[model samples]
Target: MRPTFLPSLIVLAALLLCGCDAPVDHYPPNELYSLVVSTREMVSTQVAADDTTAVVEAWFGTPVQPRWPADQMSGSAAKALVRLDNLERAAGRVYADQDDLHFGLYNEHCVTCHGVSGGGNGPASLLQNPYPRDFRAGVFKWKSTARNARPTRDDLIKILQHGAAGSAMPTFRLIPEQDLEALVDYVIFLSVRGQFERELISGAVQELEYDEARPSDGLSLMSIVGGDEESEALSFARETLDRITDGWARADDAVIQVPPETVADAASIQRGREWFHSPKALCSGCHGQDGDHPLALQTNYDDWTTEFTSRIGITPSDREAVRPFRSAGALRPRIIVPRKLSDGVFRGGDDPQTVYRRLVTGIDGTPMPAVNVSDQPSATGLTSDQIWDIVHYVRSLGESE
Candidate 1:
C-alpha cells in the first residue's frame, strides 16, 4: 500500500481551514550548509560563498520582488523559458495584485513544505520518509528527460496535476490551469536558480580561491555564466545559466526514445523473469526475488541527503555528524527504501508507458538505475522488445501478490 503521510495532510488542512496567511515578505536567501563550515576541508572561504549569494540575488532577485535580465537575453534565451510576470505571480504572499489578478500561487500551495528558498526545509520538510524534493538540486524524481537533462514543461505539469501517490506531494488537478502554469514556471525558475548556486559551490571547492582582497571576482565569474556567454573552464557550471535556460527550451528533444511494446504473454513474462534475476538486469538486488523486499535490506541515500553525507568521512546514517545540519534547517535524513513492486504500488504511474520510462531513464536522485536498451538486437543490452517483456513480468508479479 502507498504511504498515507496523514500528519502532513492534517497539518496542511488545518492551516488552510484556520485561514493561515502565507508570507509576502522577502524570500529567505539560499545559502551554503553549515556542515561544510565544520568540515574545514573546503577550498573556498566564507567570503566566496557570500559573493556567490550576491550574484544569485542580483540575477533572480528576492521572492517578494522577482526579476531577470530580459533586455540582456533578447530573442528566445530568457523570456522563452518563463515569463517574469508569471514568476511574480507564483512567488511571495498569497494575495491578489493591483489589477486584482491572483499572485503568490506558490506561497498558497507550496511554501509550507518547499520553503521560501525551495530547499525543502519548511516546518513540514522532515515529516515524510522520502521528503519533499529539494528543487535546488535541479534533480526531479520523475521525468521523461535523459539523464542530467532538464525536464520538459509537460513533465512538471503532470506531477502537479497527479501528485506522487506514496508521498506527501498532493494533486493540484482541481486548481485553475493558469495557476498551475504559474506553479510550473516557478518550479523551473527555482530549478534554474538553484542549479547555478550549486555549480558555484562545486566550483569554489574545486577551482576557486578565497581571496581576502579580491572578493568581487565571483561576480565576474557569474558575468560569463548569467551573461549569455561563459568559458569552458567550468564544464558543468560553464554557461550554467545559459545552459539551464537553453536546456529547458530544448527539452522536447531530450526525451528517451521508446519503441513499440512487445505483447505481454506468458512466454514473454517467463523470459522477463529470467532477465530479472540475471546479473545483467539484476532487479532482485534491491527489490528481492518476489519483488517484495523488506526495508531492512534497502538502504540508499538521495542526492539531497548525500550532498553533505556523501563526503569522504560522512554519511546520512551518522546521526552525530548530521545533528548540526538538522538543527540548522536540513531535514532528518532517511534511507530511500525500494518499493515493493509485488504490492502494485508504483510511485510513478504504473501504466505500461510510464513503467517503460522509469526503466529507461531511472528515477533521479535515487538508487534505481536505467536498463540498457538498444534498437538492434545486441548482446550487450536488452532491446526495446526485451524490456517490454521485463515490464510484463514486473506487472505480473503485482498480480500474483
Candidate 2:
C-alpha cells in the first residue's frame, strides 16, 4: 500500500519470471503419472523385441517355422490357422479370455442340445426327435465313407459349415472364419481325449483279465482272488476292455471328402412316406389314417397301457408317476401315442430329415423300432425305397401343419 503502482507491478513480474509463487508449482503431481511412465517404458521394451519370429519362438520355444510345402500353405492348414487367428482377435475384441472361447461356443451352440458335459441330455434334447449326438459314446452317424466309421476332418467341417439337411443343426456360416476353425480344433481335442480315455479303460480291463487268467499255485494268489463269480466277471471285463482299446488305437485316418450339397436329395423324403403307411410296416396302426387323426391311430391308451405294463412288470400307477414325464397329458389313462406329423406339438423340431433318421435308426432304449424300407424282406426285413417314401410323406405334412 505504501509503494507506488509501477513499483508493485515490477515486483510481481520479477516473482513470476523467477517461478516463485507460480500456479504450476502450487499443486501436488498425480500418483498415476509414475504408473503411466512405467507402462510406457515397458511397452517400449516389448516393442523393441516384438516380431513374427519372436512371437512364434515365445509361443513354441522353437525356431521351427510352419512347414508350408512347395512354398505354399495347404488349404486345410491355411484355413485352420486363419480361423485360429480370427478367434484370437475376436476374443480380444470382446475382452474375453482364451477359455471363454470354449465356454461361449459350448453354451451358445452346443450345450443347448448336447448337454454341459456333451452327454446329449440337455433340456432341449427332450423335445428333439433324433436327439443330439452323445459325445460320451464317441459315435457319429453321418460320415464321408461308411456306417459306424469315424468321419474325416473335412466331413466334420462341411457338416459344421452346411449343417445336416433334416435336423436342428443350423448352418453356422455367420460365425467368423477364425472362430469356426477354433471350434473345429476344440472338437478334435475332445474327440482325441475321449479316444485316449477309452483306450485307457480298455487297457485296464485287459490287464484285469490277464491277471485273472494267471495260474494260482500259491496262497498269495488265492488271497488275491475274490469270489468265483466276481473274479470271472472281472477277468471277462478286462479282456473286453483290452480288445476294444486295440481296435480303437488301430483306427484308420478318417478324412471326409466334401461333396456337393446336392448329395442330399429329396428322394429320401418320398421313400420315407411310402414306407410309413405300408401294411407290413404297421405305422398306420399307431399313427392313424393319413397321419391326421387326433389320437394317432385313435389308440386306446388304457388297453395299451394295461398290455404294456403286463409285459414290462411296471404297474400303471408306477408308470404314471415316473419323473420327467413323457406322456402327452395327465388324463386318467395316459396316452403315449407315436408322434405324428400334424400334431401341434412339434417334437421333431422342424427337421424332417431328423424325423427320417429317427424312423430308420429308432431311439435307443425306447419302443420305437428301426424301420429301414430299403432292405429286402430277408436281409433288413424291409423293401427298397420304402423308407424314402415315408420320409417324403412326413415332409409333406409340414406344409399342412
Which pairs clash (backbone N, Cα, C closer than 3 Å) in model 1?
none
lDDT of 1 by residue, 205-224 (tens): 54654343222433344444
TM-score of 2: 0.41
Badly placed stretches (over 4 Å) of model 1 are: 1-24, 32-41, 71-78, 96-101, 204-208, 211-238, 294-299, 375-380
Highest TM-score among the candidates is held by which one? 1
Error (Å) of candidate 1 at residue 146 is: 1.1
For model 1, what is the error of residue 324's alpha carbon versus the real structure, in angstroms, after optimal superposition? 2.9
Candidate 2 regions exceeding 4 Å error are 1-117, 120-133, 140-171, 195-274, 285-289, 292-339, 343-369, 372-380
